[model samples]
Structure formats: structure tokens, C-alpha cells
Target: MLNASNPSADTGITPARRTTMLAVLMMIYTVNFVDRTILATLGQAIKLDLLITDAQLGLLQGLAFAAFYTTLGIPLARLSERVNRVSLIAICLAVWSGMTALCGAAQNFVQLFLCRIGVGIGEAGCSPPAHSLISDMYAPRKRATALAIYSFGIPLGTMVGAVSGGWLVEHFNWRVALVVVGLPGIALALVFRLLAREPVRGAMDAAATTVATEAPPSIRETIAHLFGNRAFLHITIGATLVGFVGYGTGTFAYAYFIRMFHMGYAELGLVYGLVGGLSAGLGTLLGGWMSDWAGKRRRSWYALLPAIGLLIAAPTYIVAFTRGEWITAMWWMLLPGLFHYAYIGPTLGVMHNLALPRMRATATALFFVVVNLVGLGIGPYATGALIDYAANRRFSASGLGDFATQCPGGVAAPGAADSLQSACTGAMAQGTQDGIVIMLLVFLWAALHYLIAARHMGWLKREAVASPAPARQPG
Candidate 1:
């Protein structure tokens, strides 16, 4: 059995042990995502059962979850620095797993909303500690690849959520699907608690002949340290912008595909959930590998490649959105899918490299907090709101408003057409087009942050006050 408490003082772990830890972390990550994403895939079922609106779905998916998830990450990350990380992660997994099951049982909007907040709070405890732990387990040279491998949870979870949740919903119901998916996380938590062990802080420091035995930085100090790193600031903001579009697209793409392409639930599961997700996973790994290879030659390659990738992705995504044919759209989707993921690994790598070992988790938590609040919290809502706004315009033009003067839902415009459905569809189509174009432009703005990060990469490396010194080999 593995030690669940502290690591050995000789933090120079064997290769096999390091590999085992990475595997455990990846598994934990997979469970983390599975719980998070199932809700997004089953949105229609949830909406139908609860009689909720799109705006409410946005809150469920974004703000409610993000509110606590973002705020709690810093405190949890700080705690990990001072305590046993593996134990912290195990405890969080249990809490979130229970909350996930609770979501399935919610009978009303408030209950479901509160459950989502609980899920977020639990998830907030996961990444920062895992990041800090992996930083010590692998040398700086290997950290990006390790982290990328761990990050595979995002796509893997998405695939499972899409495919499994879709099939379950078709056969049974959303409540049952949530229960099935949520229950597995509890077993995973026990497994982690039994098998995982905490690693020594700053264990990868190879250059320093003498170890620094000082305590970890306080919360304010950790934050101040991150704020001082210019490249991290630019890259974090850039990543947030990318997330705004990336996450926004993920939440709405199914609805859009169903509307635009008439894709069945199973079809949505196969194409976007399976094909699209697998591609993103591959892209994430490849991006990390490329960063490792290219970063060795020029550090700016960390941010440069992603900027270039996003620039290429922008035009292709526009084409993907404009297509009337579903097959044509999916094909175009493949190209941008490859380009879209090129940033995640490198961006995360840059973040870890810029922070002290003790502060890596805190830095990442802060990064996640801002990124999720601005990006995940707002992205879906922005799209839904835009669509709603466009709906108003469509109704106004069709004179439906006049027709339903006393109706709370309002009416279609006068010249819109004979049938309300056709008028609504036309308006929605136009609005959807405008909304997507606006979201795509967000990528262009995000790309600039990557470019700015590219220029400042060297400065970030120099700003590291307590980064692990290059590791030493045995004589």
C-alpha cells in the first residue's frame, strides 16, 4: 500500500513511483470532469423536467458553479501548500461526489443551483494540489507533458458525459444518468485515499546543493508573487479569453448542432462528444509535446505556437459555423479542433514554470478563479443572452409583439410571416449567426494575449524567485 500521508525526505523518487502517481492523478482528473460535464450534455432533459429557461441553464452550467469554484480555489491551494495534498484531494473528491448525486435528486431550481455550488466547491480543491504535486514529481523539462497527460480528463470526461449521458437519457432519464455517473466518483475517491501519497515540496530542485527549509509563502505573498510576473498575467488573461470562447462553445454547441443540423441525441454524442473530444485530447498532448521540444530551443515557443494555432483556427471555425451541411461543418470542425487545443498545455506549462513550487498551486488556483469567473461563468450566459436579444429583434420585425400585446411571452412581428414558428426560426437563425461571429472574434482577442506572452516569456522565467533549481544527477 502507498503512504497516504507525507513523502520520504529523500524526495528523489524512483521513476516507477512517479509514473504511478501521474496515473493516479489522471484517473482522479477523469472523474472530476465526468461529474462536471454530464449536466451540460443533458441540459434539455433537465430543462424539460424542471421547466427551466435557457438563462437558468446558463446559471446552472456557469455562474452558480463558478461562483464558489473560483472563490474557494485560493484558500484550498494555500491549504495544500501547508498540509498533505493527497489527503486534501481525496476529501474533496468525496464531497463533490456526494454533491453530484444530490444534483440528481433536486426537485426545484434552488436545490439544483445549491447542489451545483457544492460541486464547484469540491472541484475547487482538486487542480491546484494536483498541479503542485506533479510539479515536484517531474522535472521542469517533463512537467508540461505530465500535466498535459493529466489534463486528458477534460476530453475523456466530455466524451463519457456526451456518449454515456446521451444514451442513458434516451433509455431512462437525466436523473438516473446523473446518479449513475455521480456514484462512480465515490469509489474513485476511496481508491485515491488508499493509493496516493503526498510528495515533498520542491523535490525537483536539482541545482541547489543545499535545500531551503523555509515555510511556504502566505496567501497574500503567493498572490503578490504571481501578480509580479508579467507574462503570467498576460497569459492568464489570454487563457481566460480563450476559455470564454472555448467553454461557451462547448455548452452551446449541442443546442446549436441540434437546431442547425437536426442532429439526434445519439448523433450529437458520437460527433461532438466522441469525435470532437478525442481530437481535442490528441491536440492537447501534441501541443504539450511540441512545447517541450520547441521550448528547449526558444522559450517563447511556449506561447508562440498557441498564438499561431489560434490564428489558424479562427478562420476555419468561421467556416465551420457558416456551413449548412452537417457533414461539412464537422469536417471544418476537425481543423479548428486541432488548432483550438494547441494552447492549453503550453499555457499551463508556462504558469507552473513561472511560480515557486510552494506557490504553484495557488498560482494555478488564481488563474482558474479568474479564468472561470470571466470565461466559464460569463461565456454561456453571454451567448444565451445574445440569442434572447436577437429573439426580441426578430419578434419586433414580424409584428408578433402587436399580435400578442397582452401576452407575457410577446408576439411575432407583423411582416414576419403567417406562422409564428417560421418567424421565430428565422429570427433565431439570424441571431445564432451573429452570436457565433461575436464569439469567434473573442478568439482573435485571446490570440493577442498569447502573442504578448510570447514576447514576455523570458521575463517570466527570470522573475521566478524560488522555482526548483535544475535537477542534479547522481554522481
Candidate 2:
């Protein structure tokens, strides 16, 4: 547990060093997300080429990457506690980058899936160690803000992946885009290895003065400590639910635009990349800043802001998913993007506060396991499967049941895709819209958890003061 009074906050940190390190880490994280999520941007191309179902696409997006990532996350997180975190991150970055490039050359679904798994295996080392490093550099008060800044990588990566991926797919191909995006990370990893220095663990805490030689808790103990907190558990549930809805919806958002609004890939990339990415980035920063500011006044506000944000996002997303025109629909998405991402910085910040400093990596690793395993593992596939079901159902209901054999959506002839484009455009949009609209409702579910976490904040804080150690034992 944090000392709550961080006397070490004033030591070992210069503004210049802090800013540079955060920026570098953010760049690394950005690259990681780009590699992880670039697949979604290429959904149409991959789907058509592979001739696979949406569920299979979801499997590639969610399970293939997340299975290895969530599984290896804990042990690698355990390793981060004792090893040079910088080296671990660098090595992981290189491996994932290389594997991401390999995704370009995959000759079949199995090969691509395996390559995604390899990317996941390498990426497993990223967040926990990065979180540990960030916690060490920033004080408790500034932690959320710092972490939020670091998390900017998510939106940035999404931006690059969307725009560049769209361009690559349009001008060249998906394979070239993958290789192009990936090769840069290898060089960046080497640069990170050469330039970044590891901060002394827990240097931002009062306890840093005395525990220089203390060993971090065993992995079992670390997990026990983090999971022992009821508030932490509630927050984890909220975050997991958020990831579930976010990934599920986002994985298909590009395709939705293409199918719903008849947007070209170039337009889809630029519009979504700029509008969605920028809005999400702002929302992420705002969420972190809001939590930090409000938490200083009332700790519960950390979760409260996100809860409010999620509630606001639900309606916005519902509207976004329902509408057909790209112009009006994107306007609805701005607020949803902002509100949807608000939970990330604060939730992770709270988890860091919940555990002992030395266990920060382990704690974050555990958090990712629940969030990723449930969210990433299931969200996209669920949405994809629903799309398939709903599309088939809508096709059948439209009195085009006979044509279902030729076209899955019954909106096209087998060889004349553009021939019936105008007649059944609405039917084409129905399935994906329904799929997204259903998932958007899940924001309300996640919001409820955030609310519950806030309700327990006072009690949890008091308990933290009373005996942080007892919280380390599984209740």
C-alpha cells in the first residue's frame, strides 16, 4: 500500500526527466496499441480475403492476441518486480514488433492467428512494467495524471492505425500496412533500450527511504493483496465491462461506417482516425485529469467522474450506432468517445494505490488479466457473432430468404455486389447497427459498477489507513 503521505515525491524527480520519460513511454505504448489494434482497421479486407465469419474475425481480434497476453501477463509481471523493467519492456517491444510484421506474411488464418498470439506473448510485458515505472516516477497525487498521459498512446495508436492502415489498404494492401507499421517499433525498441533508465522502485513514496533492500512479495502474495480489496474488485469489474463494450464496438466501427454510410476506406480512415481518435484522446486526458482533481477533494470522485462519463456515453453511443449518415453520426460519437475512455487512467491509478509499491507491476498485471480475459477475449467475438446472427435474421425477414444462399446479407447478388447496392442498403446496415447498439447498452452495466465502487470508497480509504497489510491477505 502507498504511504498516503508521499514524502519521497519531492525527491529523485526533475521536471525535464519526468516529461521526457513519460513521452517516451507513451510512444512505446502507442506503438503497442497500433500493433494490437491495426487488425480492426483492416477488418473489411481481412474478412473478404480470408472468407471467414465475423466470429472468426473476432477471434483473431480478441482471443488470439489476448489469450497469450492475459496468460503470460502474470508471470512476466512477476518477473518485472525483480528484473530491469526497462530491458524487459524493450525486449517485449522488439518481439511484438517483429511478430506484427510477420502478420503481413501469414498465408492462412491459422498462421495469422498464431502470429497474433506471438505478438500477444511479447506485448504481455508492457503495461505492468510500464505502470510500475510510472508509479515510481510520479507521486500519488500526480499518478493518475501521469498514467493518463502515458495512456494517450491508446488514442494515438488508434489514430495512426486507422489513417495509415486505411491508406495502406487502399493504395497498397493490408499486408504492406502491417509490415510498415511494425518495422518502426523494432528501431524504437532499440532506442528505448539505449536511452531510458529505470527509476528506483517506489521512489515516489515515503517508504522508499527504508525499504531499499526489501524483497517484493511473491506472486501469490501480490495477487492476494490486490484482489483482497473489495473496492478494487468493484472497480476492476467496471473497467472490465468498459473494455468489453469498447473493444466489441470499436472492432467493427470501421466496417460499420463502410457498410452503413457507404464511406470509402480513405474517408473512413481519415474521418474515424481524426474524429474518433482525437475525441477519445481528449476524453482519456480529461478523465485522468478529472479524477486527479476530484480525488484530491473527495477520493470517491475518482470513480464518480468515470461513472458519470459512462452514463453520458451510453446514450451518445446509442445514437451513434442508430444513425445512418456519417456526418450526423460522427457528431454523436465525439462525446461517447470522450466519456467512454474516461475510466482508464483513474481505474488504473486506483489499482496502483491499492497495492504495495513493489507489487505495482503484479497488481497491474492481475488487473489486465481480468479486464483483457473477459473484455478482449469475448467482446469482439460476441459482437461479431451477433452481427452474423442479426444479418442473417434481417436478410431472412426481408423476404430475401431465397437469396441468402448467394449473399449472407441478402443485399447482393453473388457476382453483382454493386448491382443491388441501393435496394437493400438499409438491410445491410441493420445487423451491424443492432450489434453495436446492443453492446452500447453495456456501458450502463459498467457504469453501475463504477457507482458501486464509489459508494465504498470512504470505507476502503479508512481501511487502507487502518491496516494496509491486512488487505494483502485474501479475505
Candidate 3:
């Protein structure tokens, strides 16, 4: 549907304008993640205050938001290409920002869940357009670096979210914290609308010389084209697997610390927040830089970079799990966090390179669907369910079998083992620790996917030429 070779009507763009726009886009990205991460940081407090289960928390953090985010991203991205990207992004930001603040006002589980869904819907506009925009802003050679700078939002935003959410939640209630963290994005929405201009679409195409194509490929066609791409398929699957592990780790790490080592919110905010954030940020940037540098020689390194990083990361995370000392664990976790997130920027660049200009946003959205559905939607939920199962197992182990027994409706009906149930409940904290260990194994499994992808990287890149669209310039 999208002919990469097709050109739009713009002359070459100045580097200065590109740089300025990218900075603004990056700032907006930072806000996007900051708002998103804040909820994760305050998860425990929210759980306690709202009297919900970890499974429910997982739902809120994972599927409830990701469902809309992953689903709507593609259509919206398609819309961005057809309309003004800046306007689309601005409106989405405002909606999501308002939704974030609404989260603060939620008095019950249902309300909060609804608000999270709104947040997801709003955030759906982000990556597709941003990826598309960045592609317009930079040439392929420099795209990874620009993307890495944009991806820096993950770490920095995580840091800000963690520290800010932790501090606010620790001092006040989760609601107030939500209000404080969410409101800034609303202001950013206005700033973005006023200051940011959509760059000429497809302006950076290296080969095509035409003015423009009037319509984007149909959604079905975009999918068919992208899915037909072996590299896109492999990387999409690979990235999804990695996301499963990465997001799972992020969701549970703080809670695991609390259960195993008895760390509180403040400590988590301070130690994991600051340390993990810095490490992740550094990793994100480093990974991008390395991919761009290495990719120049071996185009396959775009995929290889993540493969190598994940391989190294798996063992370090294993060690991190066993560490009893908080300081020791924190130190070990820093680099691991950085390396774990390094896959983001390069992976995005790869997606941009592989897709035709018209479908860039839609391509990104499609990737988001896979990545978020598998990774964000299921990761935390699976881990939480595992934790819940572990809790049940712990209860049974303590001779609370009858008390923990499930009835016809999957409800836990009090049985003859109430005494044992009480005993196991007394040790619920330990059960949670064991569950976290089990969850860590998912990451190990995810790492293997990256290796598999690396082996096929050469074939993937070569396949991009199969449907090579004529290169185009910005309109």
C-alpha cells in the first residue's frame, strides 16, 4: 500500500528545525511516560487504599490500559498521516492528561479502571505519530540517535514518576499524588499545540523524487504488507517477548522488594526509582548510539544490539533476585535496568526503516498492538496471577488446604482448614516473595527470543528491499 519510493512535495529540511521539533517531541514523550509510570510507582498504596487484589492492580496497570492503547494506536496513526500530526497529538495529549487527573478523583475500583482506560486511549496517539514524526525529522542514518533521545523519556520519565509518585504517595494519598503528577501534562498539551509544527511528511526519503501520494494504504493492506515482512514479524515477536519480560520485571520489582526485603515506598522511590531510572536512561541512550554505530557496518546489528544486551541482562537479573541486601541488590540492578531497556530505541528505528513512509505511524501502531498486547497487557497480569497462585499454594502448604479450596464458581469458600488458612495468611508475605522468583523466570525465557531474532537478522534486513517503495520527500 505504501510505496517507500514515492516522494512528497517538500524541499530538504534544515537540521536546526528538525532538532528543535525533536526536542519538543521528546519533552512531550517524557510527559507521556511520566504519567504512565506514576501509577506503577504508587501501585501498592493504591492497592491498599482501594482494598483491591494484586490481580486487579495488574488489570489496571496492564490490560485495562493496554487494550485500548494497543487497539486504537493503528487507526489513530493512520489518521495522523492523513491529517495534521501535531493537531492529533495535541488533542490526544489533552484527553489523556485530563484522564490522568480524573484518576485522582476516582473513589472506587470501577472509576479508576475507567480512568486508566481513558489514559490508555489518550496515550495511543503517542508512539505512532511520534515515530512517524521522528522519521520525518531525521535521515535513516541518524534516526536511531534521534529515536534514542526520544526513548530517553522511558528512563527519565520512570525516574521522575518513581521519585515523584513515591514521594507524593508516601506523604499523601495515592489520589493527591495522581493529581500532582497528572496535571502537568495538561499544560504540556497546550504548549505542544501552540509551539510544535508538523514536519513535512516523508521529507527525508533518500530516493523518491515525487510530490506526494494522496491516500494511505488501507489498514488491512498495511497489515498484510508489514506482516509479510519477515524482519518485521521476527522483530515484532522478539520485541513482544522482551516487553513481556521487561514490563513484568518493572511491575513486580518494587513489590518483590517490599515482600522479601521489607522495603517501604520511600526506599523504593529513592533506591529503585532513582537508581533504576538513571541506569535505564543511560541504557536507552547507549543502546541507540551503539545500534546506529554498529548498524552502519552490519545492518543486522539493529536487531543484534538488543539480542546482546538481553543475553547479558538475564544473568544479572538472576543475581539481583537472590541478593538479600538492599544496597547490594540496588547496585546490581542499576546496570541491568539500563540494559533491559536498551532495546527500545533501536527496535523503533528498525520499525521505521522497515515500513513505507505512509504507513510509518500505522506500522508503529501495529507493533504497539503486538508488543503491548503480549508485553504490557499480559506481562503484569500473568505475573500477578502467578503471585496469586503462589499465595494459594503457600496457604495449602501450611495445611490450609480446605480453607483455600476453590468451589464451583472459582471462589475461595471457607472449608475445614480455616486454622491452616490463618497460619498461611500469617505467612502471606513469604508466599509473595516466592511468587516473584517464579515470575523472574519469564524474563529468562524472553531473552531467548532475542537470540533467535539475532540469528535471523540478516535475512530480515534483506527482505526490506522486496517491497521497496520509491523514496519520498516531505510534503
- Higher-scoring candidate on TM-score, 1 or 2: 2
Off by over 4 Å in 3: 1-13, 207-211, 400-428, 459-475
Q: Tens digit of lDDT per residue, candidate 3, span 1-475?
A: 2334333335345667667777878888888887776767887777666766667878888888899999889779888878888889988988888898889999988999999999999999988998988887776666778899988887788778888887787788789888888888878878877877777667777444332464677788778877665555666777887877677667767766765676777768877878987888889988888877777666667776777777778778878777878789888887677677788877887777767677888988888899999889998887777766777666566563532343111223357256543454444455555656666666556556655555555523543331222223357
Q: Rank order by TM-score, top first?
A: 2, 1, 3
Tens-digit lDDT track for model 1 on 99-151? 98888899988999999999999999999999998887866766778888999
- 10 residues in a row with least lDDT, candidate 3: 403-412
> Which model is ahead, 1 or 3, in terms of lDDT?
1
Candidate ranking (lDDT, best to worst): 2, 1, 3
lDDT of each: 0.75, 0.83, 0.74
Q: For model 2, how does the per-residue alpha-carbon lDDT over 246-331 read when each residue is reduced to its tens digit? A: 88988998989988887878778988899888899999998888887777767777777889999999998898777757898888
Candidate closer to the true structure by TM-score (higher is better), 2 or 3: 2
Q: The CA-based lDDT of model 2 is what?
A: 0.83
What are the root-mean-square deviations of the candidates from the true structure over C-alphas? 6.1, 2.9, 5.4
Cα TM-score of candidate 1: 0.88
Candidate 1 lDDT for residue 216: 70
